[model samples]
Target: MRSTVSGYSALSKAHKFSAAGLVTVAGAAALTFALVPQAQAADVQSAGVKTVSLSAQEFGVTQDGELAKAADDAAGQAQVKAKAAVKAEVKAKADAADRERASRSEARKPMKPAAKPAAKPAPAKPAAKAAAAPVKKAYADNLDGWISESLDILRAKGIPASYDGIKRNIMRESTGNPQAINDWDVNAVNGVPSKGLLQIIDPTFKAYHVEGTSWNIYDPVANITASCNYAADKYGSMDNVNSAY
Candidate 1:
């Protein structure tokens, strides 16, 4: 029986040791699993805390994008400003040109004055008249005898020679003879036709012949009256009576 107890204790101890060893192994495996999880968490935290650094290529690309955006915005603003400035300048030039044109037009305009009438000249005055001359004595005395016979015949004719100068011219022409003839005539042969008293020829007799004288060339009253009428007609107012007959 003692041998049997000793074998049972020895088996019991062996089994207990074996169970303790199994529990230790399982605890060690569990502890390793937990430590692995903790190590992985610490590695993740360390990676998150590490500082990141960029390469030249990555930094240039980032700066280039920002610069391109800035250039685009500046270009847009510049275009707006250029358009506004161009419009303002064009408007200003047009206004200035219009003002200049208006100024030139005003300067070219014509000025006007009041209308005036033309004047007329005054008229000039007239000049004065001249005086008359006197008669002489020598010419009156030489003209006396012919004056009486011209008056006698003119009295019979009822038409007297009014002036003394006219009668003197008649006596000088025919000596108061009714049948007196000029010597240019002959009696019978080679006789040129002779004139009557006062030496009146065929032309004078025909020009002054009276209707009541009966064609007689020697009729004293008819001859004398005709001679007086001829003298008055030849001279104006009998003033040049001697030269007229």
Candidate 2:
């Protein structure tokens, strides 16, 4: 019985060593599985972060392009408006110039005229001349009667009366009519009464006397005698018959 008990004890010791080796192998396999899975997860996370940054850069570039196009459109509209305004101003200036030229042309046109003058005239002329004298009828016929009467009167007065002297006195006194008077006779008021064929005044007859008769201015014979004596004493001759006593 003792031998059997020792042999069973040795078998028990061998079974314990085999169980320790199996446990060490199981622990090593579990550690290896856990470390490998952690490494693979870190690599996947880095790749995701790089992809997000690329998307944000592309969005910024698109927004800048849209703003540039809007600015260019606004500049083009401003240029078109300026060109239209310049054209309108030029057209207005041309119209004003045309109106001024028309006014000047109207102001240039023309007018009319007036009248004339007159003339003058001329002058005038002169006049003419006259004629001579003549004789008488009684002196040609009764000259001898007158001569004889005058000589008788002279002889009575103691004076000489020639035939020529007597004839001249008769012619002067009455043109031989013994009844003559001046056509233009006027009566005397201031000096003396006058009378007869010879128109002898009172003063002249009183101053000279005739022989055998009172002085009578109205008697042709008395007047003739007195005038003959006065003429002989004052003037020497009776030849100028028209102008003598």
Candidate 3:
């Protein structure tokens, strides 16, 4: 009975030691889990801060106020250049129209019937050239005379309008009246009424006014010159236009 009791006591001691060992192992495992998470969390937070700082620096450099203003100024300069280019294109077109009119004037010269079919063709060309030279005519007050005078001026200025074209449009629009006005039309309602022989609106007259013509819309020469200039801008030349345009 004594030996059996002794054996039982030893067995109890062994079991207690085993349980203690297991508890130590469990505590170590718990500590490792807790410490590892803290270290990982610190690293993650540091990386997050660095990312945020870099983003802020990038925004500061790219979207700063001074840089933004510089970008806007460049855009404005580009716009100005574009507008100037458009103006240059318009000027080039007008110049081409003038050259075309001069060519046509040359072509319209009357030939001297080949100098009675006996003279050289070269002399005939010279005769045609002399005929093509503008003849100085006394300006008259009548519509016919006025149109003839206006054609002379157009020829001098290299404008491409013809007497027939101008006269036809004037007769249709204002019946040869220099002081004509459309007081009931859309232009009139807008306070920019069509005035003068060619039915020119006020804005059109102002924008296309010629250098030597009178400022008054009722002035015959002024109205015709301005109308021709406007036509040149709109349709290449007055000779190219017909009808209600």
Candidate 4:
């Protein structure tokens, strides 16, 4: 019976040792689970921090690039505007200079003379009229008219004589009788007879007959002109004769 009791005590001790080993293995497994979870959490937090920093750097780079591009564009636009302004100003100045030069050139030129008005044409003259016929002058029908007519003929023929001298000579020769004849005188002894107011012979009357007078020897105007012509030739004039010439 004692041997059976010892065997039972040994079996109890072995069961107690197995139970302690099991408890230790359980405690190690629980500790490993808690430490692995804490380590995984720390690694996740670090990866997140790195990811956030990289994202912030990329955003900054993009923003800087945009700002630089904007600045370059603004600068380019400013340059273009400035150049356009400068070109416009230069053109304006050139235009002003051209205008000023033209003004000065115009001022230096001489003033033009005023234009003269066109001359008016002269008026046409009227046509000349034809000459009219001369009117005959009327004289009295008397001895005075005959004497005046002879005197007018003598003046026309350029013969010079006086009315008083002719009348005095006519009164002495024929007593103012145009038809008287001196047939008994020295002129009558010849073939030609003296006749008319001045007693002129036919040959003497023909030789001294004035133009525009009657050819008849007894014609009063014809005889007077012919005798006066003969007297003017023989003597200085009929006015100097006081008797038969």
Candidate 5:
């Protein structure tokens, strides 16, 4: 009986020691699990922070690209506006030149051609006289007619002259003769004789002949008109002409 009691006591002690060891191991495992979760959370937080930083970098890159694109668009717009302005200026100049050329051409053209008579036998003398009276007379035919025509042109071309003024000069210069010439004057001795109703020298005629009239200095209308131009240049207007000059 003593030997049996001793063996039982030994077995009881061994059981108690084994139970304590199991409790200690369970506590260590629980502590290890909790620490692992905390480490994982820390890793997740670090990764989130890195993701946010990368997102910020991407946003900055996008903003830079947008700014560059906006700058490019602005430059392109400016180029287009500049080109348009240049094109408009060129067109305006071309249009102005065309209008000037047209005006000059109009000035060089004849007013109208003389109409042809009808292809018919001769009519009675009274009827013929009546028909001839109705026919439009040319303004360049006589001195009175030439002066009147020149006054009309001067008004249109912005050249200032008057009927009384032109008539007075014409009567004094050449007695209203379209073919008058100054053969014995100082100008004649100089080989630059003054001719025509206005007594204009060849050099003077070539210099001051009206633009829309005949280029011939002896032409009645051309003579009167050219004289007016010269008179205006020398003395503001033909009305001021009262001397040999």
Candidate 6:
């Protein structure tokens, strides 16, 4: 009886240990199945989120490229505008300079000379009259006139002579004759006859002939004046003569 009891006890303990091990194994299999499905679902969700992040990054890159292109286009348009403005300014200045030069050229043009006026005709003068002849002084054609004319000539020639002395000498020499001749005298014998009113020889008459009188020895006034001039020279004056000098 003691050996059977001991064997029964051993068998009971071995069976209980096998049953517990089997229960532990079944629970581990159920937990492993449930955790495997959850891990698969988490992997699918993570893949979806990674695909969205990649799409967003690609969109951001495309937007940055478009913004850069816009900025470059704006800079190019500004450069073209600046160049056009500069060209317009240069053309305006050139046009203004050309206008100024044309204005100066017009101002410097020469003016035409004025026309001259015509001259007027001169007025007519009255006809001129013939000039009158000069009047001559007259004297009588006689011995008294001859003496008076000789006295006038002597007075003009600054020769000193008196009427009484000249008449006395004339009466003694030729008796107041203009055509008288002393043919029988010593002067006549020598071929130089004493002739005229004062009976003056040819050589003596020419030597003492007064200017503005006739050269003819028979001219009464010429003979008397020449004789008076000669007598005045030799005797200081014809008035001092008292004889046939």
- TM-scores vs. true structure, each candidate: 0.29, 0.32, 0.43, 0.50, 0.43, 0.46
Error of 5 at 7 (Å): 99
Top candidate, metric TM-score: 4
Query: Whose lDDT is greatest here?
Result: 6
What tens-digit string does per-residue lDDT give for candidate 4 at 59-125?
5677689999999999999999999999999999999999999999999999999898898888887
RMSD of each: 23.9, 31.9, 46.2, 20.6, 34.8, 22.9
> Per-residue lDDT tens digits of candidate 1, residues 1-245?
11123223112344335434533533322122111233344452333222111223354577689899999999999999999999999999999999999999999989666676666656655555454453421222233433444455556556536655545554665665656777654531345344445656655666766444435666654565566556556664334566524
Candidate 3, residues 145-172: lDDT per residue as tens digits? Answer: 8777777777788888888888888998
Q: Which scores higher on lDDT, 1 or 2?
A: 1
Q: Which 10 residues in a row give candidate 3 its minimum summed lDDT?
A: 27-36
Candidate 3 has a TM-score of: 0.43
Q: What lDDT score is found at residue 236 in candidate 6?
A: 82
State each model's CA lDDT, in order: 0.52, 0.51, 0.72, 0.72, 0.74, 0.77
Q: Candidate 2 clash total?
A: 0
Model 4 lDDT at residue 24: 54
**What is the lDDT, from 0 to 100, of the residue 192 in candidate 3?**
84
Q: Which ten residues in a row have the lowest lDDT in candidate 4?
A: 1-10
Residue 193 lDDT in model 4? 74
Ordering by TM-score: 4, 6, 5, 3, 2, 1
Candidate 2 lDDT over residue span 178-213, tens digit each: 545444435355445344434555566666557654
Flag clash pairs in model 2.
Answer: none
Note the residue pairs that clash in candidate 6: none
Q: Write the per-residue lDDT of candidate 6 for residues 89-203, one digit (tens) a residue.
A: 9999999999999999999988767777776766777677677775655779987888888998999889999888888889888888899999998999999999998899999
Q: Which model, 3 or 5, shows the larger lDDT?
A: 5
Model 1, which residues run further than 4 Å from truth?
Answer: 1-160, 163-166, 185-194, 237-239
lDDT of 6 at 10: 19
